[model samples]
Target chain A: MSTDSAAGLLHDLAEYRARARRDRHGYWLPLLVFGVLILAAPLVYLPPSEWPPPRVQVSADGLFPGQIKVFGLTIEPLYMFGPGNGREIGNPMGVSWYWFGVVVLGLAGTVGWYRWRARRVGVETPTRLVVLAGSVGLLFLLGVVPLILGQALVLLFPGSYFYSNTAFWISVEVFVLAAAGTTVALWVRGGGPRPAWRVALASVGVVVALMSITIVFEAAFGHGHAPLLLLSVALLAVAAIERSAFCAVIAALFTAAALLANLYNMENVFYRFGFHVDYLNPRGEVFANLLLPAAVLIVGGGIAAWSARKASRRE
Target chain B: MSDHPTAGLDDVVHQKHRLAILTIAAEAKRVEFGYLQQNLDLTKGNLSRHITVLAEAGLLDVEKGYDGKRPKTWVRVTSAGRRALAEEIATLRALVARHENLS
Candidate 1:
């Protein structure tokens, strides 16, 4: 071909590369939404006049007592279960409510300000395989290992395990081991080209990110948050890989999972635990509590996927 | 046609801006004109001129719509345009190889 045609092709290729380098709306929006959703409940929750929504309570005698023993750890039962009356337990994260909102809001605002000020560009694709494996490993360590060890400890020292310092120490050690394992796994796969120091730094960053997420989620909702949290992370990652219509489908699946989680949590706390508080508008409260958030997640994911498709059509 | 890289290059797709437009359009189901213009860093007049030429050659399907109140234009590469672009690139690569051999 002529010089002009060759030059044109090169120009187009260069343009494509440049566009690829710039951050697309598709990935960033969903990521931002994910961050917001994760932080929103903890940071922006306002106490209703009638707290805990509408629920029916059943009196259980001595079901919970002061410093109830569980797997060798003496933990406070937020609920009072005595002779004639048993009150609903306040959530473990209740103390966090006093300070969590201000702290999270401040942190989120500061980060938002910094990001906006910096006006950074470009999309950085994490090592998906390494990150995925490390994430799964992290979950196993944080979750499965703890339960297994706790069970073993209970079996080994039936009487002594309760309210023991050993339990706390064991928990700490397991946490560290899990974090280290995940970081090392990530580094082994993705750190070869980087300097040793950089690898160490990246490993720390990965560990910190994973740990912070675990802590925030654990702190925010404590038990039963894991399944939905894992689902969200997995779906978002998949959306990044697939993009567009497929992402929309993933978003829908994520919504379904989230719905199940909400139902399960509500059922566990409300009916099983018999901790029910009246709502000003019970039906509206139920709809707002369960359906609204699920709808937003589903729609938000769809929009993000659509934008991603439009922005980067290539698979 | 001669057995030269330049022999069968399509004129509509040979221009710099138009080629970039085609490549971008080919990637998306239908690429917004604004995306093409912003990505290629071309002024409205310049992009319009190139887009008009490609449209005339039946290489681009241009659609006019409204994004809320604002008018929007979207462009997609026709099948013919996709074939032409592929042929053009292949020819251009061959031309480069032949020239390098000569050098």
Candidate 2:
């Protein structure tokens, strides 16, 4: 080959290498941040003795006392009790650290995977970042803020909190049902224009029926039964007919619900091994409680947006 | 002898770097000027000139603003631009199909 051709080939090879380096850099930075966070979780759980113990106050008549003797294991409360004798408990050390690790790692892994795929296909970072930001923003607006506000209100009002109100409970159930239904419907539609009213209504019906079956199954088996298992199955069925986002959104909704149930002590199980783990310190709890869902939302949203953009380009 | 018109359809749509800008805009719906510059690996002046050409042709709309102290420029495709792109793609497809048939 001529010198000109050889020079062109070398330049092209250099360009390819540079692109690869940039992509790798993008992939590793998020992973490193996530890994560091996970590694640091244990420190939060087993803080130095000099680090002031999280202040926890329990009301004399708090529904669940600071101490619970369950099957002979003495479990201390997980949140901090305030001046009003309201029970304050922090996360259990093992559970909290485990969840913090899971969430941070999960988020970083998801974001990294997404960016890697986009880079492989030559999608730009700004577009990916916008989608990521949008997803996180939506999650904060829908899930994290509500959770924080709910917890704060519960702490402030103690006995008089709306968390225990029938209306509020009904609303929560309705919202969950709606979210699950919409997710299924969107999945069925498969990134097309929104479905017609009848289709949407039918999806809602299906969701309600599934929810009813779950409740009945729970009643038959035991109250502490895992709702996520059923939801996951439903999501799988939806995935078979529709898009993966439907499944992802459904899974996220179920995860959020499980988190909420744990937050309120509605679930008899304190924390499961995989996603429900929490970091035990008050500051850690605050961080995990606020950050985990936010991360999931952002990461999930970014993937969805990026996918949508990719599909559009192909068309 | 070729009887068909619009033989330059590919030339129109696949012009160097212009297609890149259009592809980016079409996927993103709206994109920042700095982002376009970084992703397309173009100098600010080169990108600005290309953007000006597209804007002149009514293929794109450009907006400029400031974020705190930093100036920002955003670009989006116009309806006419989308139609033109669609026509260009169709013409190219037709040409390919004709060539395949002849072969």
Model 2 spans > 4 angstroms off:
A1-27, A47-56, A59-315, B1-17, B27-49, B56-58, B66-72, B78-83
Docking quality category of candidate 2 according to DockQ thresholds: incorrect
Clash-forming residue pairs, model 1: A1-B5, A1-B6, A53-A277, A54-A277, A55-A276, A55-A277, A72-A161, A72-A162, A72-A163
Against the reference, the lDDT scores of all candidates come to 0.51, 0.46
Judge candidate 2 at residue A182 and give its lDDT.
Answer: 62
Residues A78-109, model 1: lDDT tens digits: 21111101113233234233223322343344
Q: Encode model 1's per-residue lDDT on B1-103: one tens digit a residue.
A: 5577777677678776787787766654466666666777899999999999998999998888775687878677799989988887777777777776787
For the second chain, the TM-scores of the candidates in order are: 0.91, 0.80
Roughly what TM-score does model 2 have, to 2 decimal places? 0.39
**DockQ (Cα-based) per candidate?**
0.12, 0.16
The C-alpha TM-scores of every prediction are 0.37, 0.39
Cα lDDT tens digits, model 2, A74-141, are 33332111111221233343433344334434544545564455434443233243235434533432
